[model samples]
Target: MLPTEKDAGSASMSQVSTSTERANQADVAYGRLKQLILDGTLPAGAQMLEQEAATRLEMSRTPVREAMVRLRQEGMVEIRPRHGMRVLPISASDMAEIYAVLTALEGTAAELVAQRGITPRQLAQLRGAVADMQTALERSDLKAWAAADEQFHLHLVRLSGNSRLIQMVGQLWDQAHRARMLTLQLRPTPSNSVKEHADLVDAIAAGDGPRARKVHEDHRRRAGTMLVDLLDRLGLNQL
Candidate 1:
C-alpha cells in the first residue's frame, strides 16, 4: 500500500517516537539493574527474574529482558540451564584476571593522557569525582564510594580518547566493580582505598605517566591480593 504525504509523515514520526521511548526505557532498566547488582541489593548467585525486575521498574518485561541480556553480555550475569539467570559469583582468580587486564589498559591510558595532556574540564571532573569519593568514605557510605570509584576509572578511560580501549576497559571495570563491592562489603573501611586514589590523582595532575602507571598497577594488585586473601579466609579460595 502506498502512503500519501500526510500518512508518511505521521508514520515516520510515530516510528521515531516509539524508538526514542524504547531507548529511554532500556536505559532506565539497565541503570536500575546495574545499580542493584553493584550495591549488592541483588546478591551474587541470586536468581534474576525478568518479570520481577520489570514489575519493580514499572515497565514491561521486554525491556527488562533486554537489560538482562546486556548484563549477561557484560559478564555481570550468567544464564544457566536449570538456574535461569543468576548473578555471577565473585572469584579470586576472576578478580586477578580482571585486574591484570585493567592494569594494562589503565597504565596505557595514563601514558596517553600524559602525552596528550588532558583538558582542564576533564581534570576538574575527575577531581570532583574524587572529592565525592572522599565524602562517601568519610560518611562510610559503601554504595556511594563504589559509584565514585567507578566514575574515577571511567573518567580516565574516556581521557584516553580511544573508543575501542574505552569499551574493553569498561567491561573489565564492570567485573572489577562486582569484586570490589564484595570486598568493600566485607571490610567496609575505606582508608587504604582513599589513600591510593589520592596518590593516583596526584600523579595524574603532575603529568607523571610512569608514576601514574605504577600507582595504578599497585592499586589493582593490592586490591586483587586483598580479595584473594578474603576468599581464602572464607574457604572459597578455589574461586
Candidate 2:
C-alpha cells in the first residue's frame, strides 16, 4: 500500500530531525575539545586521538571526528595523516590578529547596545561581571580574572541582542584563549577590563553608541599592541 502524503512528509521531517541532532552533537563535541585546548588541558603540540577524545568526552567517535574537522577549519588543530590531531601553537602575530577581529565584532556590539539601551536586568549582569573582575584582580587570581574578563566582554556582546554576533564572537574568543594564556603568563595583570571596561560600561549606560564603540576599539587595539611588544621583547615574536 502507498503511504499517504502526510506519512511521506513525516518521514522527511524525521530525517531532518535526525540530521539536526547529529549536528547538535557535533557542536557539543567541538566545544568540549576546544575548551580542552583553550584551557591547556590539551596544550599546543598536544596530539588528540579520535577514539581517545570520544572516550574522554563520552560521545561517539563520529561526532568527535566531525568536531576535529571543524576545529581544523578554525586553525585550532591540525589533522595529521594517519596520526592524532595537533593543537596549533599560536604566535604573537596571531594574538594581534585575533584581538583585531574581536575589536570589530565587539565594537559593533557596543554600538548596538548603545543604540538599543540595556535593560535593568542586563545592566545588573554587567555590573556583577565587573565586580567579579575586581575581586579576581584583588586576589591576584589571574585565572579567575581571565574568566571574569571573558564574562564581561561576553555580557556586552550578548547584551547587544544579536545572536549572530554572539555566536561569531564566542567562537573567535575560544581560539584566542590560548593566546590569552601566554599573555597572562608574560604579564601578571593581563586584563583590559580592569581599566577600559569601566569606561565603556559607563558609556553603555549613558546610551552613547559612538563613545562605547570607540572605547572598546581602543582597548582591543592596546591589548593587541601590548601582546606584540611582550612577544618581541621576549624574542618570541619570530618564533
Question: What is candidate 2's lDDT per residue for 1-239, written digit by digit as tens?
Answer: 99999999999999999999889999999989988888788878899788888999998888899999999988888998667689888777777788889999999999999899888888888888888888998898988888888888888998889999998898788877777776686764755567788888889999999999999999888877877778878877532
- TM-score of predicted structure 1: 0.81
- Model 2: clashing residue pairs? none
Residue 9 shift from truth in candidate 1, angstroms: 3.1
**TM-score, each model?**
0.81, 0.86
lDDT of 1 by residue, 90-115 (tens): 67777778877888888888767766
How many backbone collisions does model 1 have?
0
* Candidate 2 wrong stretches, greater than 4 Å: 1-21, 188-192, 237-239
Worst 10 residues of 2 by lDDT: 185-194
lDDT of 2: 0.85
Q: Each prediction's Cα lDDT score?
A: 0.80, 0.85
Q: After superposition, how far is residue 13 of candidate 2 from its true place, in Å?
A: 7.1
lDDT assessment of candidate 1:
0.80
Say which candidate scores most in lDDT.
Answer: 2
